[model samples]
Target: MCVAADWRRLYWWVVLQWVVGVATSGPCAQRCDCSPKLPLVDCSSQQLSAVPEGVPDATQVLNLTYNHLKTLSSRQFFSLRQLRELDLSANMLTVIEVEAFVGLQNLITLRLSRNRLKIIPVGAFSGLPNVQFLDISENEILVLLDDMFGEMPSLQKLEASENDLVFISNRAFSGLPNLLELRLERCNLTTVPSEAFSRLTGLQHLRFCRLGLTALPNNSFRQLQRLQDLHVSRCPWLHTLAVNSLIGLNLTSLTLSHCNLSAVPYAPLHHLVYLRYLDLSYNPITTVLSGLLGDLLRLQELHLVSTGLLHVESGAFRNLAFFRLLNVSDNRLVTLEESAFHAVGSLEVLRLDGNPLACDCRLLWVMRRRLRLRFAGHAPSCVSPVQVQGRMFQDFAESEVARTFTCRQARILTRKPQDVRSDEGHTVLFFCAADGDPAPSIIWLNPKRSVLTASGRIRVLPNGTLEVRYAQVQDSGYYLCIASNAAGNDSISVSLRVRGFPASSRNRSGSFFLDGWSFASGQTAVNGSQPFPFDVKTLVIAVTMGFLSFLSSVALCFIFMFFWSQSKGQIKHTATIQFVPRSSASTTAGRSTVETGRFTMKLI
Candidate 1:
């Protein structure tokens, strides 16, 4: 009894649903599905050779994709006055008779891709004036005649890629004054159709790809004033861009990928001051030369992936104040200099993956700001210096950089000190300077190979200058100056000969006579070798220290007075600025998503 009751309820519910559906929807063709409320008709993949009967007159959107219809006869869709979108893609359409679309006055989009049409009827598209988007790609269109699409005055975006389009007449695009975007890819254009492109004065975006073009001649895009984005990619023979090729346009986004370019066309791009995005990937460019991009001040994103990039010379990105992203991946780069980006303070994303980077001092700024910089994709790792090879820059501690990234050695910068021939009682000085990482320290050694300490007659200043006040005979001999650091050391020698000192009175340990006086084995010898008191030398050192202290105090007092007076007379700021050899990020107009060769980039 319970099962019977449930079956009766279920049958009634089904009957009610069927009645409601039929009443709401208008009469549909036996082969087509129609919804009166939505005003839509779908006959896709029906394998029909002709239009089915009983299609509602109120249908506004018609889909006939994947069909077998070969021809479109006159007035076939004359009654569908309210149709706004028509898709006839993936069909065996061979011919379209004149006036085939006589009543579609309100159509906004028309797709006729993947068709077998070699030539379109003269007046097939005569009445579609309000169409804004048209796709005639992947067809056998041989040549575009003058005024072929002149009737569609309101067309804005047109896609005609993947066609055997051989030649385009001078007036091929004469009627599309309002067209903003056009794509003409995979065509048989041996040269740029500048004459046809000149007619598109209002075009803002253009994509002309897969041609046999070797170069873009001067004034190629001179008439495109409002143009912004341009993609001229996948041309193996395109190796050059004429110096004045982009003279009169302000493009924002540009893609020149998959070309045979040997270098960046920084000369032609000098006119694109408003360019914000650029893609030059898959080229054979090896180096980013210095100041090559000084004019692209507004450029924010750059793509140089898969280029055989080896070097980024210092100042390569100079004047790029608003740069934000740089993709130099899949290259043979060893390292980029920090000084190269002194003008790039606002860059945000830096991609260095798939590169053989040597984590040296040239890239020290990157490791120092590892946390702050956003390294896109894999983190940059060292490919050299055995100890740090294959290790990410972020994996090392801040202190480790100082210990690892070091110079090879310390080199003495000055020439060898000249031999000094001074009379007794005259002062002598020897100068020595060096260059090294962490700065080298200076020390002096006597002829006896003993370190010389600062005292009454001998001293080494902070500037690495050896000063000996009141030089005597014993001071005559070889004086060696050495500069040393953590890496290595360098030394130079000077022979000091005192005129009045007798060599016969000198000892084997380099203790020579100075006016009948010498210090041998910590003993003072006078004439016949007798011990002497150290009171005289000690008194002279005391007097010299007191006098030097007095001068220093006076100098400080004068300096304070001068500064105080200057403050009262004129005000000065206490703020200071330092220019360290460092580099970082910048800003841009906005963010977007663009697909490139199967790789999608989310610009920030």
Candidate 2:
């Protein structure tokens, strides 16, 4: 009997709620369309000047976009308790009064983009507690004050792009604790506000575009530990990035495109072990050195478009094991070599059409994988070796590859360096020049078979000239110069004889010797005995061997003295022997007939 009474009361309660909703909902406003089922109001794209009156009390979605509303007075939409979305974009909104969005407790999406609003009062969005996505882009806002958002605790994404933002208060986003993404692109940021961004701990994607800074200081985004993607584009003045700028973050995607960087910021990106997508397009970087990108072991997709890259050195991508896509289009590259990569077996997409490729043996790796690479948009073509010029890489037959894509070994252009004689204090020079299909790099090796770099007394010039400042006796030796390219290498050896006094053994590495032999003449004869060039490694080894010899001699002398003293009766010596009786194997030794003696001896 009690269960039947409860069912009857529930049915009557539903009828009472329906009666109240019908009695309270008013008729639709003039010049607007309204739906009674979902309760949506469309007052958008019209010449309505103010908020439409007589709107139904049960409306949930309101559209006021593309209108001529100039101001929003207080309590404009206070009665729309069920409102969830509000769009006022593409309007001429100049001012919004306080509590303009009051009583919008369930509002979630708000769009006020492309407006003429110069300032937004504090309480303009006071009652929007559940708004998650807010877009106020393309406005004339100059600054963001503290508490401007008015505590939208459920907000996650906020995009304020294309604003003339001149200043941003440190606490401007303090009320948005759950913000997952924030965009302030196309603003005039003098410097990255690292202190202000520390408050956004939950931010996953951060975009602070168009900075007037030359360099990002160390640990610039270290506080954004949860950040996954960071983009800084259209920053022409951002040329330098500190090695530790992206030190502590675990970003997966990074875009530093459309900047004025002269080279890749490899050091700053070396620690981004989790980075998979990288875009570094439209920079002025020229060449990438061999093995410099070895640290990016997990990179999958890479973009180096329009970077004015001329050469990709050998073994440059040797460490990228699972590489997929590479877009180096619109560069000045001559050709790419097969030796530059260790393995790109999983590569799916490639974009290398805009480069002036020679299509020679250096680029045979691309030809073999042309069908599998799936060239994006356009395929690579030959720009040199007139026989195959203007031909696509995919069109060449496998049998003609060797005949067409040929390599020209590097050949020395200038004559070998002459043997020069210098005095005790002088300088020496050796020059080497070469020519090849692709350019060759120069390297110098000393008499000790070690590669020469800029050191205390020796220097390597950019134009392949070896300069030795102080011509000491130890600097006299034969030097070898090697010019290498992708095809082959050529080398030549030269001799240097420095005449000096035996006692003039001072190292003046800090000061240069100005009085040197003229490099513009033939070899000169020296009148002194040639002394061996004192190589640093050779000297250390010789000294170590001599010390070992001295130690062995001292130890032998001690041993001899100890034996001689004993032979001359100056020291006492004792020797004792004893014999013991052996027992039977059965261990039945019940009695022993002879006394036993035992003796022990050691050979040294």
TM-score of each: 0.65, 0.74
lDDT of 1 by residue, 1-604 (tens): 2223433654564466455653324588778877544567899999989777677776666899998989999988888887777899999998989888889998878899999888875677889988888899999998887888888888888999998988988888889988989999999988888999999999998998998889999999889989999999999999999999988888999999999999999999987889999999999999888997888879999999999999788789888888888899889997766677844458678888889886666577777777778987578888877778999877898889877765556788888558889866567888888887646778888777777765546777778888866566667788889987555789999888876535564332233333555556776432211332233455568899999999999999999988887788755544344332223232346654333233333422
Candidate 1 vs. true structure, TM-score:
0.65
Instruction: Give the range of the ten consecutive residues with the poorest summed lDDT in model 1.
Output: 525-534
lDDT of 2 by residue, 28-52 (tens): 8887787654457889887888878
For candidate 2, list the clashing residue pairs, or say none: 315-340, 578-597, 578-598, 579-597, 579-598
Q: Give each model's clash number.
A: 6, 5
RMSD of each: 31.6, 21.7
Name the lDDT value of residue 177 in candidate 1: 88
What TM-score would you give candidate 2 relative to the actual structure? 0.74
